[model samples]
Target: MKALSYLILIPTDPIYVPTEEQAETGADALEALMPAAEEVTYDMFDDVRFIDGGQAFEAITCPLCGKDAQAWWHNAMDKAAEAEFEELECTATCCGGQTSLNALIYQPAAAFTRFTLVATNAGVGGLNETDLTAIGVPLGCKLRVVTQSI
Candidate 1:
């Protein structure tokens, strides 16, 4: 049977910005825009998991003796610094090998804000689009899956 896992990141602080009119008028218009100013709310999502496709396999043969060699699989998650993010690693039980996957979440300290998600896949085979999408973002958040392997 195949297994799947999900991880979610939530912002602990509230997101606020100046009104459209105030932004156009400049800082001097703060007073006028204060009354009509609005707050932006970012909702958090629950983590969910589903059946992932079966593992990918590769045949290995020993060149010296011309014999078959043992093989294994691995998977994991790693988070970047800031917001006290933590890394989580999981290995395949049957394979006895491990892969450390890292999920880095970084936000700028400047006026403009940005978010980035990166993953590292270190194994013989790769993960499918559906599986990466399922694991990367929250259930409802706008998350685009961008994946590459080495």
Candidate 2:
């Protein structure tokens, strides 16, 4: 079987979601940048969802203490999943600091978002920062890109 790769753009703030029109504009902007992309789409969810990087995912770290937070993150993910990710708050074990799962630093860039703009077969390894900022303009929010292969 062949692997499929996706380039997903999500808001830097997990709780922030663009309006449908804004999302469409963002999608259009991304399409303009990746004209050879096989597909481009945007999705909106009623609740925040974890947008992981699939095989690209690596270790996670606590934003507070800069320690390996894989174990803590997993447990917190389970708890948050119970609520369908409606709540992302958690307490960090390393520093005993309170934080949100969304704030955890994910290797290879995973994120929590209620909306996403995705491009399949993006046709390029990555977008430069300038291109990303251009795409984010119409969406009215800064974006974080997550590349996933599955």
Candidate 3:
């Protein structure tokens, strides 16, 4: 059966690119927030490709200008994928600014570890402020909350 999952992207840094120390702290804080929350690394999403419609990306591309920044992005992701562990990360090479890879889409993008709080019984609408605050504040990072029913 499919279930609605609240995918909360809690990066160690506010910009979404976490340092080694911050990632570790965020992980601990997350577990403290929800003892039942299962921790996962980017590898869990082994073959996820970012495709908005029918297109597939080979690497990071500009979502707004639709430019190919794969070469630059590759270097960034390799360095940032799993900061506390393996470190897969990226900034907007195309945008020429501090845009986190977590905020952009990648084709064949490396999976960065994050949290998923499943509201199996309540579904998406049931998520509340208490739920948001509990997860957000303790982590000391911004929360990218999105729902996935699967």
Ten contiguous residues minimizing lDDT sum, candidate 2: 52-61
Regions more than 4 Å wrong, model 3 = 1-91, 103-111, 114-116, 125-131, 138-142
Task: Please give the clash total of every predicted structure, in order.
Answer: 3, 0, 10
Q: What's the CA error at residue 146 for candidate 2, in Å?
A: 0.7
Candidates 2 and 3 compared: the better one by lDDT is 2
Would you list the rank order by lDDT, best first?
A: 2, 3, 1
User: TM-score: which is higher, 1 or 2?
Assistant: 2
Model 2 stretches astray by more than 4 angstroms = none
lDDT of each: 0.25, 0.89, 0.45
Q: Residue 36's C-alpha lDDT in candidate 1?
A: 30
Top-TM-score candidate index: 2
For model 3, residues 51-73, the per-residue Cα lDDT tens digits are: 12123555656655567777676
Specify the poorest-scoring 10-residue window by lDDT in model 3.
42-51
Report the lDDT of model 3 for residue 126.
Answer: 30
Of the candidates numbered 2 and 3, which has the greater TM-score value?
Answer: 2
State model 3's lDDT: 0.45
